[model samples]
Target: MGKTTGFLEYDRIEESYLPVDKRLKNYKEFVIGINDSQAKIQGARCMDCGTPFCNNGCPVNNIIPDFNDLVYRQDWRAAIEVLHSTNNFPEFTGRICPAPCEAACTLGINDDPIGIKSIEHAIIDRAWEEGWVAPKPAEHKTGRKVAVVGAGPAGLAAAQQLARAGHDVTLFEKNDRVGGLLRYGIPDFKLEKSHIDRRVEQLKAEGVTIRTSVLVAGKDGLGKDSKVTNWANETVAPDALLADFDAVLLTGGSEQSRDLPVPGRELSGVHFAMEFLPQQNKVNAGDRLKGQIRADGKHVIVIGGGDTGSDCVGTSNRHGAQSVTQFELLPMPPEHENKPLVWPYWPIKLRTSSSHEEGCTREFAIATKEFIGEKGKLTGVKTVRLEWKDGKMSEVPGSEQILKADLVLLAMGFVSPVQSVLKAFGVDTDPRGNARASTDFSGGYATNVPKLFAAGDIRRGQSLVVWAIREGRQAARAVDEFLMGYSELPR
Candidate 1:
């Protein structure tokens, strides 16, 4: 424990950000990370409770207490080490993760939980500034090659781990740059691309080959002329991949956007959240997006109240939208959770993101029935109020309403992995349409196809980045075990 009574001594301190007015002008990271002294005080606040539930809380099972102790002592280097021991990229999660660990903190029952996430944020930012993070190449080569598809968090994590295990790892991405969802799906205002660029540099230094603009199985599914049409590499079929590489790991994300098939769905203004978000990211990266959907001088209605929806609200506001409204199918949850009942588990509660704070009209228990449009473009949305009974939701009659909107974004979340990618590999799939792979020690993450393994969103469906990292690390160990008779990679 950092301090005997640290929990009682210090209160939770929240991170600060630039004013919304100033920050909305451009897409840049606005959170001001804490300094070393502030971090120490925050670390000291960690009771490091015996039987630390924060470890269980975190998806990567980070050694929260040890890192807290290290930070409390101002051992910045050791703190980063401890943070990195479990999580491959604390910087990513430090900025974006919801921090279930805090909800699981034992101190949270009585007082505010320790600011473990902020502590990690401070530690990583400091480590990067001090040049402590570097690439560590393997001492000897295993002479085995592994191909990882997709360049998202899961793929990157698995690739990095395999590289450290002495295997030649080649990562393939259809996009122009690596960092799948992290690079494009996320808005630059939430996470900058520089973080991903630096990580790519380190991966290169560690001897990992990243082939951007490369497709693993076939031509760009987006067709001959895509928004990212510039990405064109030699096609490498999955069968050829199996013949060339010693093993193959599929870490593609769950990208099948759940669509609303209501009337007027063919309207020009309706787009998938993925379709809308990535264009802005590309523009922020200096790519021109001519005729891209803009909310400027328009009223926008974003369906779904999750992170993606919040992102749309933020982006639309930044685009100078005249008005923005968000609709949630489920009822609004309580502001606070019943701690005693849900202490060690993530709870259902109200979560107002930074985007919500920016500017938005939020509605709960509202469901969209149809998109009203004229001349094949969206004009408004027909919606109705819903009520829950016996855990089932149903719309209430006579509660219907019309919301004028110029553009609509479907942010209802993904259904599963792209079927074309999974079908290309001919891997077995679960009932939920995810790759079927066991996480047992004996089989590791191997799929029904021999020497083929799956991880991250491809295997587990849509999930948090931290969970993706955990799966990627474990999958690498499994692959290493399958490659050799034994393995030493950490779980």
Candidate 2:
């Protein structure tokens, strides 16, 4: 710890965001960077407890205390070094990550947790500005070629790690650009595409070959920003990939959107959240749409109260939607969690997103009955209130009503990774439809196939970007061991 009584001396201070009125006008990053002095004060707030639960909270197992100490002492170069030792891309996480590490902080027991994420953001930005961040190519090549299917977080992190391990890595993405969901799924205001572009540049310098629009199995072209390269027609069969490379890794995202099956499901305006979110991102990137769905001058009903749903609210507001209402199937959670019961673990509370803070009418304990429309166009939604009893939900009698709606966004969540790709590779899937892969000590991240491996959403279903990076790093270590009979890369 930098200061013996640092935790006692300083209180946690979060980074500020641009005002809602000003930020809503354009899709650009709004969070302001913290100064060096502010970062040191925040780092000093880290208790650096004997056992850092923040590490456990972080999916990549980042050495939080060491980085905190480095930041407190104004050793930003060392801070980035410590951060890079575990996380491959702190800039990405620093911007969009939910920062579970702060939730699991020791100080959170009574007071606010240290601003670990903000300090992390400050450190990495300074490193980049001071000319400390650069590509570190492997000293020697292993002469082993690897084809990783997907350029999402998992695929990119795995490719970078393998490239650093001396393996020739060729990452394939069906999309026009890299950074899987980051490039298109997330809105530009929350995270700019330039962050991903810079990383792609750095990875190329490090010897990782990125083949975007090179869909591995005939997936749709990634509609994204103009700076990305498109190569979707190019594909590598799973078995062919296994034969060509010493080892193969599948890290595709969970793209199969969970649908809301109900009457009038075929209505023109009822669409999945993924279907709507990506289009706005494309438009922001200067793509013109012919039959694009818009919420402008219309009341919109968003089903599912998750991050994706929140995204819909933000996008709809920008489109000049007359009104936006978000619905959740479950009953409302308490405003705050029972800290003693949930401390050191992710809590289930009434968490709100920045989008929600902007403007949205949220409804809990509700279910959509049908999409009401005429002439095959959605006009309104019929819904019924619900109540929970004995761990099951039932619609309340006489609680049905119709809400005016020009668009219905299904943001419930993703069901699983696309099955066709796995089927083409003949990889077995779990009951939940994720690719079958074991996270065992002996052969971590290996699929049932001898030389094939699976990681990220392909293996673990829809999950956080941090988890994808962690698995990618671990899978790289595993592949290195399988090839050399030992490995120096950290798992």
Residue-level lDDT of model 1, residues 373-442, one tens digit each, is: 9998899999999999889999898999888989999999988887766777888999989999988889
Pairs that collide in candidate 1 are none
- The reply for model 1, stretches above 4 Å from the true place, is 218-233
lDDT of each: 0.88, 0.86
Please write out the lDDT profile of model 2 over residues 296-383, one tens digit for every residue: 9889889999888998999998888889999999999999989999998989899888888888999999999989999999888999
Model 1 — TM-score against the truth?
0.97
State which candidate has the highest TM-score.
Answer: 1
- Per-residue lDDT, model 1, residue 491, is 93
